[model samples]
Target: MLVLWEIYPWRNVEVKKSVLVVLVVALTLIFPLNVFASVQIQRPVYVEGKRIAFDISPIVEKGTTLVQIRPLYEALGLTLSFDPKTREVKGGNDKYEVVLTLGSDLAKVNGKEHKLELAPRTIKGHTMVPLRFVAESVGNSVYVNTDTKRIFIGVFMTYLKDKYFDMSWGLSKEEVSKINKNDHNELLYENNKFLFYDTEFSLASKKNMVPANKIYSFEGNKLSGAIVKFNSSDDFDEQYSTYTQVIYDLNNLYRTSSIYPYDKYWIEGDSIERAYREVYKDDRMKMYEMAVRSGDLVFICPFDFADTELALFLQNKGTFSKPEYEVSIMYEQNKEFFNQISN
Candidate 1:
């Protein structure tokens, strides 16, 4: 089992709170703890898919990734403001806002309190704050590719922000066919709702997953969803381990812990055999769900926002002895699906 630090923000959450507070989700991560020197930024930071050039450059002091406060805020669409009198910095656009003291670890987001593992400070005439804290606070995703030694931060609310594979969202069949002219495996479903491309998918640039089917689901001849389903004939333990890693990967890239509060499951014993038999079991003693959600903030406030759910799932279709594991990442982009279905 890949051991992890209990540093995830939602890990300490109580079950009594059914709804995961936004503040907690903002701080949730399973980052490896390691200290380092105040060297020049070895890893280049990319915000919203654009590489940011800083005068002083980003520095990693004690394992925390710190960046120049102003550029980082503006990249996230937040206008930066500072109060010299109080040593405070404020940044916001309209819906999202952040206020923090120069030397304090406490931050205020939309009038709610959030704690940073590292405090904001001045380094070589530039103010620096924990990069992960600010990005994840306003519903953005942050990931560091150790292989590439590059930092990727996405300012997103749902589904990678208008990213739908090689094609953009809301494209017609004619538009898609022109963009991706490569020969595909499958053409159409019975009802002509899906188009499949038998290809591999790389999650957060970490692992290359060879999927059984990479599908593009359509609604009214317009692209509505992009899905990748994987199948494995591995044993129960191996399959379960792979599934959890996938979930953790997506958790950082998408907003989930706020809705599901992942700590509730697998807190006591994370081993596959124990978790499968003990916590997740059916009435027939078969198995509980290994599938978890990677939905956006739409899950928290169903009435307010359109729901774009990046649903991640793992299932043991066959028995334990001859287990047939099914792992899938499904994206359902239904703009008004919530409003139409709800009262």
Candidate 2:
């Protein structure tokens, strides 16, 4: 009985150990360790107030937001290319390029290597990349809302300025009003829907006095689009030369595609003359038009399709010449809105 009592202590210890093991196993079954892992399911992503309808929902892992590479790239007007042999994805616009490799935590922005918190991986045949790392790397702004589970990617607006005037998209009405009031050398025209500023500065010869005018179209209280007009003398050949040079300069500054044989109709005395024209496409400009008149050359560029309705209204109001020389440049991201206004 004495021997049994001494051995009983060892037996009690074994029983306690077994209970501890069993409790651990049971607790593990109740709540797996993976439950504590930082993994979030699909969430919504927005770009410039527009929702991106991605085929694969973005996931959050290890405190990083991972998104499908293609949809987000194309949504932001950036071109994306993948090399199967290298397993590398390259995306960029005219100004920046981002490079990412599958299962790599390192990314390159314009040849500068940047460390990523989580490596990009292929999920269900889609390449998922860290959104914030790639976005900010290319000079875009990335914002995440935890409570709403929404991610926002913002592209900055292009601003064009000169001695006479400064212009950009998304400008406030008050800002436009202030500019209009301050500038005395230019004639300013404003209404509830549009603001037209004619700059006294001219690119023409001294005899021509061809003024440059800027038009700003508004939606609610925000600027939606802008146009800079350079009125030329009544010389079609000279106009054609100036147009070619401007198009060449614009194409050099931006990535463009040329659409040839653009047909135009003009009334000549008793009949309409059909003329074929060519236009350079700049999809990054959102929507743009170059209208040529007897003494006017108009360059209309919109920052967003939210101004499409206003643009069509201005066209109907005869603010510019007939739509003969108009070429609208729209990106695929604005296809739905373009179609809505086009029809």
Q: Which candidate number has the best TM-score?
A: 1
Q: Candidate 1's residue-wise lDDT over 129-185, tens digit each? A: 888888877776666644335566763333344322444456776666566555544
**Model 1 lDDT, full chain set:** 0.56
Model 2 C-alpha lDDT versus the unseen true structure: 0.50
lDDT (10s digit) by residue, model 2, range 1-343 = 1121231111121110011111111111112232323344556676765678877766665678778888888778889898989889999999999899987778888998988898787766888888878777767666554333456566534453333235555578778867776543364666776666666443332344435556665666666555554553334344444444434434332212112212122213112111212233343121223333431223322222221211100111133443333222221122233343334
Tell me the lDDT of model 1 at 33: 75
RMSD of 2: 25.2
lDDT of each: 0.56, 0.50
TM-score list, all predictions: 0.41, 0.39
Error of 1 at 3 (Å): 39
